[model samples]
Target: MKSLAELAEIRERMKSKVVLREGGNEIRVVVGMATCGIAAGARPVLNAFVEGVNRESLTDKVTVTQTGCIGICQYEPVVEVFQAGKEKVTYVEMTAEKAEKVLQEHIKGGRVVEEYTITHAKKA
Candidate 1:
């Protein structure tokens, strides 16, 4: 906060860390954190995913982020997993437990948990 030059450098560093342009294949876990989602317990779901990724040492392979409304209020605590060159998997009604399972079975083992996915629940 001393000078504009220092501020610019800090901004650049933050941008680079958030952008994550390298690594050909990466997994993105997006948690909806809109008002409805928050009221429905999205924060814990998001935290769980972050912890799971770190616990499994998949930091380089997975990026966890938060988003606004996902347009499905009934499924407020929603999570979507997107892997490079593959279809997105939307998991509805998420909890910390479910998020952990997703991290283990899906992110690490490359298998989408059908039971948690929106498609399997006939809501996609």
Candidate 2:
């Protein structure tokens, strides 16, 4: 917060930090936080994931984040798991309880919960 040159240098440092961190081998848990998602209790689901990560002391191994409109409003409060060098797993209609199960069974144990996946739904 001094001169323009100082501000530019700070901005460059922040950008570099983001890029460096983004290139790491961290698992990302992205929760949908659009209006539909929020209405369906996305906040608690997000909080549960954060709490689980912290409780397990896997902060460096995992990152909890949010997104908007996953294009499936019926599956609001969706949680998508992205592990480096692995296919993404999308969990639909999440709750705090379910999120904990996901964190334990999926994130920690490296197993996807097939029962909660959208692919398991019956097409009408």
Candidate 3:
């Protein structure tokens, strides 16, 4: 049980993350969270992206959200990144570790983690 003050503090901490998801961001990270995705462990991958965005203070620039099946169940736990002026990049076979690296390299560093993306995954 938390005191009112404690709850308030928690709310404040979470408010930024909520805002990041709902609006005002240039980058959008969409994780497939359907039944298939969950069975394939998308929850941890989603958590990693959320935690990574918060840790890097990228909430202002990156928005993380979830969606239904991305029509790629064979590639469950898929993540798609969308930027206003760029093409969407779909990453498949995601794990928490891979999500973290995507946050660091693709989201923050302005370069896609090609090997983790569908285009590259299909090649290997």
Candidate 4:
């Protein structure tokens, strides 16, 4: 705030934490953040994805972003993963802990965490 150089420094630091949607990433992880989603705890789920991606050094491959209502209110706190040339996978009833597992098993390992997926929720 004191000088132009200091402002630039702050901007650079924050740019690392901000996920831009300009597109080049191999995968996109979107979190639903509608009113219902927030009530069901989407914020932490979103943060978890962001932090997990950086921690795993997959930021170049994955982009984590938030969007309003994903349609299924019952599935509040929902997360959707989109990979190029692949079907989108939706994960429901998410928690921060679940986010990490999804990061490791799904994002890094190239496998879907089916138990947390919408199809599994329907069966349950």
lDDT of each: 0.88, 0.89, 0.92, 0.92
What TM-score does each of the candidates earn? Answer: 0.79, 0.79, 0.87, 0.84
Where is model 3 more than 4 Å wrong at Cα?
10-23
Instruction: Kindly indicate the candidate among 2 and 4 with the higher lDDT.
Output: 4
Shift in Å, residue 96, candidate 2: 0.4
User: Cα lDDT of model 4 overall?
Assistant: 0.92
Q: Write the per-residue lDDT of candidate 2 for residues 1-124, one digit (tens) a residue.
A: 4799998899888786566555464799999999999999999999999999989988768999999997899888899999978999999989999999999999999999988888875342
CA deviation > 4 Å runs, candidate 2: 1-25
Error of 1 at 27 (Å): 0.5
lDDT of 1 by residue, 1-124 (tens): 4899999899888786656646543888999999999999999999999888889878878889999997998877999998878999999999999998988899999999999988777744
- In model 4, which runs have C-alpha deviations exceeding 4 angstroms? 1-7, 10-23
- Clashes in model 1: which pairs? none
lDDT of 1: 0.88
lDDT of 4 by residue, 1-124 (tens): 3899998999898786666534569999999999999999999999999999988888778989989996899987899999999999999999999999999999999999999999999999
**Candidate 4 weakest ten by summed lDDT:** 15-24
TM-score of 2: 0.79
lDDT of 3 by residue, 11-54 (tens): 99988777556657899999999999999999999999999998
